[model samples]
Structure formats: C-alpha cells, structure tokens
Target: MSFSITLVIIIITALISWRAFQDNDLKYKMMFYPYNVKHHKEGYRFLSYMVVHADLMHLFFNMFVLYNFGQVMEYMLDFKYGSSLGTFHYLILYIAGGLFATLWPMSKNADNPNYLSLGASGAVSSVFFAYILWNPGATLNLIILPFWDIPAWLLGIAYLAYEYFMAKKGTSNIGHDAHFGGAVFGILYVLLINFEKGQAFISYIFN
Candidate 1:
C-alpha cells in the first residue's frame, strides 16, 4: 500500500526543514516576510513557510501532532467518502487551512517589513482541530504533565481564548493569529463537509 498522506507530508516537511536550518538563503526564501509580499511580490512564501520550521523541536512537535490527528482524520474521511475524494479532501483541508491562514498576517503586517513568521503551527492546528470535530470527547495529556488530562473541547476553547487574548496583546513573538485562524478554518472545514457532524458535536457537549 502507498504510504498514508499524513506520513508523506511529515517526511517531506522534515527533510526540507532540516536542510532549511543549514541554508540561510533557503530559510529566507521560505519564511513569511511581509516585506516580500508587500513590495517584492514573493507570494510563494505564504505556503513555503509551512514546510520550514524554526528548530528541531518546533518541527517535531508540529509533525507529531499532525501525525496523531491527521492520520485519524484521513482514515475517517477515506472510510466515509471513498479513497480518491478522501485523499483529495484531506489535502485540501490541510493546504487550504495553511493558505487561508496566510492572508490575515499578510494584510495586517503589510507595512511592517521587519515582521516575519515561519512554522507549521497554523496548518498543524487545522489538522488537530479537524480530529477534534469528530471526537470531541477525546482527551490529551502532555507527556511532561501526564496528570493533567484535558478534554478536547475544553482545550479547544482554552486554546482559542488564549490565542485571541495574545493576538490582542501583540506582545509575544508567537503567531497567535495564525494559530487561531488555522483552528477556526479547521472547524469550519469540518462543518462544511458534514453539517450533521457539527450538530452532533453541539448536542454531544450540551446534552
């Protein structure tokens, strides 16, 4: 059997990101520098940024989460809708989430030539939340803090809240806007694909 789409994505991203770490020019080309979009018109940076990460840990964390959530979501999609459409939809949801998330930062930071953001956090968040849409009761425990078992929906709410607050503060270097945008885009994608699933999600929590 062919390797799953999730694994393929992870492998490609890892290889490029590792090389990007060593090549300054590659990293500069991959980074989402608003200056490039605003003036020089290097719009490809929007999607290229997703494949390059800041460091080993950053790549590992994002790819690990993508592996966990993306595999399951793709499996569900393939099972529910047939193989071809499933793979295509999975591809769309991921790349679209990343592509869609880029617009906001580009528009907001068009004038700030110094502003640069790079990482797959936004795309990873989309995959993470897409899985949550199906299994809201799912819970996660950080490896370092196994005692803290948090429900997915609660964590999702907390995540959005934190991102929103941080985006407003604009103090941290973190791309909270991208995080939030990816998350919302994921949820919306799931809803668009299957509205009944969302209704069930709402009913599952409240009832």
Candidate 2:
C-alpha cells in the first residue's frame, strides 16, 4: 500500500486536539495568539496552532476537509512529480499554507492581547483550493445543501468572495482572513509549481 501522509497528519492532529480539549494550558500554549507571538518569542504558535481546536466540531470539520482534499492532492502530486518529491511539495503546501494564513491576522491583531485563533482551517483551505485548481470542472456540493452540486471553479469564486467580505466585515469570530490567505497561497503555490497547470485551469474554467 502507498504511504498516506494526509492520514498521518489527521491522526496526529486529532490526538493532540483531543488532549488539548481537556488541558486549558496546552490549548493556550498551542493556540495562535498574535499578541504573545509578537511580544514574546512564541513563534511556534504559528505552526502549533494547527494541532489544536476550540471544539470537537472545529477539529472534525478541518480534519474532514483535509482528509478528503488532502488525499486527492497527495495522489495528484505523486502522479505529477513522483512519490518523494510529491510528498515534499504536499508538506510545503500544508505547512506554508498555515504559516501564510497567519500573516494578516498576526499583523492586524498583534496589539490586541485578547486575540486568539486555532484550527487547521487555513491548511485545509489550501488543500481545498489546490484541488479545485487541478479539478476545475469537478462538482462540489455545499455541505448544508448537498443536493445542489456546484462546479469547483464557481464554488472557489464564491468562497473567496465570501471570505473577503466577512474579513472586511469583522463581525464574526471565524478567521476569514486566514481562509482567504490560505486559499490564495494554495492557488499560487500550485500555479508556481506548474505554470502549465495554471493554463489548463484557465482553459478548463473558460473553455
């Protein structure tokens, strides 16, 4: 059987998040607190935050997305670049997506000592977007309305628009900024790694 890095990540994240749920200190230490990241040298939170979640639902959603999209991404990468290099790129996409997702929040909330964020939403968003880029014609059903299947590219556009709007509105606790940032990173990363794929993606969407 082929090795599955996505499953490994989900297992590790689930274990850590489960333990953190019972330990406030662990959660706090692992959460993405921009204030501490700026004031103190707790830069590890940038990556560590992906391993914890505010609740079971949050963990399940992020991991579920990661599990579905991430496996697809892994297979695509391996098919394109072979096993070793593909795994490396997958790691880069996930880790860098998480790191990139924190940039805007870190800058905007650095002074707000109460600001806190957690979960693998950013990383999962990256994988989801990357999947859309490669499979633009694929049908994606809304979780709430699963019967209505939307084209992957159209869903991507709506998702980005909603995230941008929500981030600007700043009324919700959800990290819309991170979602947008991670998605952008995903698309850009895929394009950079394979410019030909970008051309194919455009043609698939338009023609």
Residue-level lDDT of model 2, residues 97-201, one tens digit each, is: 999999999989999998899999998998889899988789977779889988989989999999999998999999999999999999999998998878998
lDDT of 1 at 173: 91
lDDT of each: 0.88, 0.93
Task: List model 1 lDDT by residue over 1-207, tens digit each.
Answer: 155999999999999999999998899889988887879999898899999998999999999899988998999889888889899889988998897777778778998988898988998888788888878888888788889988888889899999989987889998898898899889999999988889988998998
For model 2, name the residue pairs that clash.
Answer: none
Q: Which ten residues in a row have the lowest lDDT in candidate 2?
A: 134-143
Could you tell me every candidate's TM-score relative to the true structure? Answer: 0.96, 0.97
What is the RMSD, in Å, between candidate 2 and the native fold over all Cα? 1.0
